[model samples]
Structures are given as C-alpha cells and as structure tokens.
Target: MARQPLAPVRPPCRLYLITPPHIAHLDAFAAQLEQALDAGDVAALQIRLKPAEEGDIRNAVQRLLPIARAMGVAVLLNDRPDLARTLGCDGVHIGQEDAPLAEARRILGPDAMIGVTCHADRDLAWDAAEGGADYVAFGAFYPTATKETAHRPELELLSTWQETVEVPCVAIGGITVDNAAALARAGADFIAVSGGVWAHPDGPAVAVSRFAAVLAAVAEEI
Candidate 1:
C-alpha cells in the first residue's frame, strides 16, 4: 500500500499556549492542557526544558507528553532533538544558538517537525528554511520578562516573512491573548509564548482556555 501523506499541522491560530518548567500543581497543569485542547486554538505544545540537562528534560517529557498526546496537541521539545525523538514528541525546536537545522532534521528524520529561531532578520529566516526547518520563529517583538531578547524582530518582518516562506512562521516573545490578534493579522503562522499562559492570574487552565479562545476569535475575523 502507498504511504499516506501526513496531515498538515497548521500554524498556531492567534494564541500559542506555552509550557514552563515551573508549575505549582501537577494536576493543574494537566487540567490546563485539557482546557487548551478544548479551546482549540493551540497548534503545538513546546516543552521548553532549560539548562540542557537530559535527566531533567526526560522527566519533564514523561510528565507532559501524556497530557498533550491525550488532547491531540503536537508536542515539540526545545533544544534537544534526541530526547524529543526518544520521548515520542512530534518535533524539536532549536534556537540559533542550539543546534544546526540540518543536524536536527538528520536526527529527527524527514517527516519530523523541526523548528528554528531566527530572531529579527529576514535573511536568517530564509537560511533556516533552506537549512530544513519545518517552521521558523521570530521573536522578542515585545519585551519579555521570561527570556531576555538578544535580537529583536520588527513587525514588518512578519509580513515580509509570511510572503517569503512556505514553511509555517511563528511569532514569539511575550505574546498574550490580548495582543495575539495583531500578530495573527500580520500573518504569523504560530505565536510562541512562555509567560503569557503560565503567569496568568486566573490559573493555567483558564489561561490556556483564554488563549485558545483568543486564537479562535482571530480566526473568525480572517
């Protein structure tokens, strides 16, 4: 039998709910994940495990994968391609400082989703796409308390990028449900977030659901 074509994973709607390493309640995290899935704005869940330690990340993947998979949310492990494949995550996200895109693709195989961080430069994004990235991330569009910006991308870059690249484009950096529509209008395929969902006063589940709603709202307008 011929191999079936893989269904395309669309870019995140308007809001991309991100997972952080710190969660006060494990059950709450899972519940929040369920809420995000129910909300239906999510494109993928990036499991950001910092400090690049194997045991630490493995533990995180073990805890988070079940929740994501249960909800049919694609999981992308940050910075560690090997661990991502090992943990059965759908993809790996690499920063410019992390690993090469070709390297990531080679390890993850042809069909695996691999994302790259290109910051603000259009040329960089083009390079990443040529290098075999499934998606390209641009960020620090807004000041983020979570991670300091090394290079900032201009808003116009989003429009330019959307036109240039066939691969999905992700706009990251301190995005919240409130501001996500602008990015969506600018043609971002995905909106990567870190603190927005996790740091919400309403709690993670509400945060996730809220972001999801925001994304849906944006989609309706389009």
Candidate 2:
C-alpha cells in the first residue's frame, strides 16, 4: 500500500522519557525524574513497570504522575488501560499483545492520548493511525537491552512515516543521545528513551540536556 504525506513537523523532534522497567524506590526515582524534566524539554513520560504487581504499578503512578503532570509532560501508563483510566493517566501505550486500540479508546475517551507500538511495520503503523491512535511507535532502531524485540526498523522508516501520516510518530528502543539525531533527522516527531536517559553515566539530567542539544542541532540541519 502506498503511504500518504502529511504536513512536516515544525521545529522537528522532542524527547519522550520511559521509566526503567523496575523502579524500586519511588521517592528516589521521583527526585531523579524531576531533575531530568528540569534539564530539558520532555514531552511525555511513560510509566513502564514490567513483571510488577498491579499495586506496585499503581503506587508508581500515584507517586510519579503528579511530578510529570506538573511539568506539563503527558503521563502514559504502559499496557493497562483500565488502571490508566482509573488512575487518571494522560494516556496509555498499548503493544500488539496488549489491549486493542478500540478498547483503550473506550476506556480513555477521545481527549486522552493513546499510542500504539507498531514496531518496524508500516502497515501496522498505518492501521494504528487509521484506528485513531494519537501516535504510532516504531523501533529497536538500534541495539537495545531495554526490552527484547526482533524487529529492527531502519532510519528511512521514520522518513516514510513522516511523509505519510498526520498522526505523529515515535522512534523508540535503544535510542540515546549518541544516536538520537539520526532518528530526528529521519522525521521522528519524538524519540523515546529508557536507559539512555535514566542510566546515563553522567546522570539523567545530563542525559536529557545532551539529548536536547542533539535535537536542537538536528532541527537546525533538517
């Protein structure tokens, strides 16, 4: 199927932060999150806690949502529309194996943002946009330990999606300050990072600031 072109994104890309799979100390992480937010322009924060009990997810959301919201960053829960709605999250990110987009919309309502993981498949991304997802995520663009997924999308895919869809696209998985500029120039509206920011040697704040610098540089060149 042929892809359709949409308006070009103004000022290029921004940062999207994802939580480390396990946030053992909510209070400490909350402080770290605040520092990162203060360091740069963060558009959203995804609370992605894996293999955790429902209560733990809820607790993390309860502690972190306010901080994100206060910073004017959207808060998205990973894979739990029910909890997302119940806890008043700004949105939810649903993977292919997770709940369907329709169900998530029904749970989150029209105003809430919902993003879907489309991996490296343009068809999936097209379907997701057609299905009313606020954004479609394509990724593992580089090697990543954050999660295991076989699909590794190329930088060109971002250009294709940008030229085709009005709905914004996110490039995630193993993205970091070092390699993020390529994705931005390729037309990703947002670059989602997990360990790239959270586990940076200089710390999350430095990571975010560096990413912001990269995005700014790319925006100018593109």
The most accurate candidate by TM-score is 2
Error of 1 at 75 (Å): 0.6
Model 1 C-alpha lDDT per residue in residues 21-55, reported as the tens digit of each score: 55556566767677656755566889885555677
The window of 10 residues in a row where model 2 has the poorest summed lDDT is: 3-12
Which segments of candidate 1 are over 4 A away from where they belong? 1-14, 21-28
> Candidate 1, residue 158: CA error in Å?
0.9
What is the alpha-carbon lDDT of model 2 when measured against the actual structure? 0.94
In candidate 1, what residue range of length 10 has the lowest lDDT sum?
8-17
Candidate 2 per-residue lDDT, tens place, 1-222, comes to: 898998554666999999999988899999999999999999999999998999999999999999999999999999999999999999999999999999999988999999999999999999999999999999889888989889998899999888767899999989888899889989999999999999999999999999999999988887
- Clashing pairs for model 2 are 4-164
Count of backbone collisions within predicted model 2: 1
**TM-score for candidate 2:** 0.95
